[model samples]
Target: MKNTKAMRHSGPSAELEAKGLHRLAGERVLLDNISLSVHGGDRIAIVGPTGSGKSLLLRSLAMLDPIDAGEVQWRGESVHGRDIPRFRSQVIYLQQRPALVEGTVEENLRQPYFLRAHRDKHFDRERVSRLLSSLGRGDSFLSQHQRDLSGGESQLTALLRAVQLDPAILLLDEPTAALDSDSTAMVERLVIDWLSEMPSDRATVWVTHDDEQSRRISNAMLQIHDGKLSKDVHERIR
Candidate 1:
C-alpha cells in the first residue's frame, strides 16, 4: 500500500519523505510501497511487533540497505548508491547491538577521527569527557577494554562516540534495550539533552518497542506493521 501522506517533492518543508519505497530479501518482501515524511527536528519513535520491518526502514534511511524500488528524498534530493557514503556519514546508524571494536573506549572514540575528514584535527578530550560524564560514566572508562564493559557501558560509549562525531541525524535501534534502569535513565537523559542543545536541522529516529521509553525521548510516534508505516501520532496528549 502506498502512503497517501508521502510528500511528492521535498523543499524547505521540514519533512523527510519517501515515495513508493520497497525492499526484499530473496522472495521475502521486507517493505512494500512504504512512504512517510519525517520533519526536521522530529524525534520519531518507530514501534511495532517483531518482524515488522522497523529496523529495515531505519537501515534504509541510514543508506545501509539498498532499496529495490522507489526513492528516499532528503530536502528534494534522491539518496542513491554514490550518495550513500555521504548520507551515512551525515546520518549515523546505531545497530541493535553496539558494534564496538576490540579496544579501549578512548581508542573507539578516536577511530572516526582517523578518517580522512578529521585526520588532521586533534581529538577533543574535553568534549569526549563531558559526554561520558553526562552519561554517568567516568574518565577511567577511557582506558577500560571494550570486551570488559557491560552491555549498558558499551552502549553509552558507542553513543558518546557518535555524538563526538556529530552527525546530522541519529538512527538508533533499541539503544537502551539491554540497559539497567539507572543506565537507561542516564542514556535517556543524554539523548534529551543532545536533542535540546542541537540545532533544528538535526534529527533522531529511535526504533524501540518500549512505550515508556518512547514517551520519554520522542515528540512523535510512527508505527510499522506488516512491512508498512501504520500512522503518525503526536506523543504529547493534546
Candidate 2:
C-alpha cells in the first residue's frame, strides 16, 4: 500500500524544502538551483558519482554549509539564529565517520543531552537498548568501550545517538559505506525499523552510491549530477 500522505497530490505541508539552493566555489557551480521538498514520512535516496556534489547538497540541506543563494525551510518556515540550533536538533545530519569519545557506548549516546539544544530531552536507555538489540546487539553492547568497537559498531553507536533523540528528519551520508555486508544489512534494518516506528511523523534522506541499497531503502530515488537534482528518475511508490 502507498503512503497517501507522501503522494504528490496530497499530504501535510513539506517538512523540509530547499528553494533554488545554490552553492558556488568561485567560478564553479557546486550546487545549482537545487530545489527539493521533503514531506513527513519520506524515505529519499540521493545517488550520484563521486565529486558530483552529493555530499554538498546534503550538507547544504542540513544548513551545515552556507549556501550562496536559496533558503532551507523547516515546517514551511525559514530557519535562522536560535532556530538553527533547534532545527539542527530535529534534523540530524550523520556522516560516514562518526566521532566517538573515549568512553562507553552508552556515555556517547547520553552526551547529546548535555547540550543546551537537547537539555529538555533525557536519554532513554531502554529505547537505546531496544534499537541495539534490533541490530543483534545486547545490553553488553552499550557497556562496551568505544575504542573496543569495530567500524560497524561505531556507526551503530552514531546512528543510535541520532535516532534516540527522535529527530523528525535524518540526513545520512554514506553511513554504512565502510562496513561489511552483514553490517550494512544491520544498518539498513535499523533504519527500516526506525521508519516503521513513526511512519507518518519521521523521514530520512540517505545518500549512497549503491543502486541496490537505494532501491531497498527508499520509497523514492533522487539522482544528483553536476549539482542538480532530477525528480523524474524514480517515481514515488504508489
| lDDT of candidates 1 onward, in order | 0.77, 0.86
What residue runs in model 2 are displaced by over 4 Å at the alpha carbon? Answer: 1-10
* Tens digits of per-residue lDDT for model 1, 14-105: 44567778998899888878876665577778888999999999888776778899787766688776666666666788887888988999
- Please tell me which predicted candidate would have the highest TM-score against the true structure: 2
lDDT for model 2 comes to 0.86
Question: Cα lDDT for residue 58, model 1?
Answer: 87
Candidate 1 clashing pairs, residues 3+ apart or interchain: none
What lDDT does candidate 1 reach at residue 198? Answer: 69
* Residue pairs with backbone atoms closer than 3 Å in model 2 (clashes): none
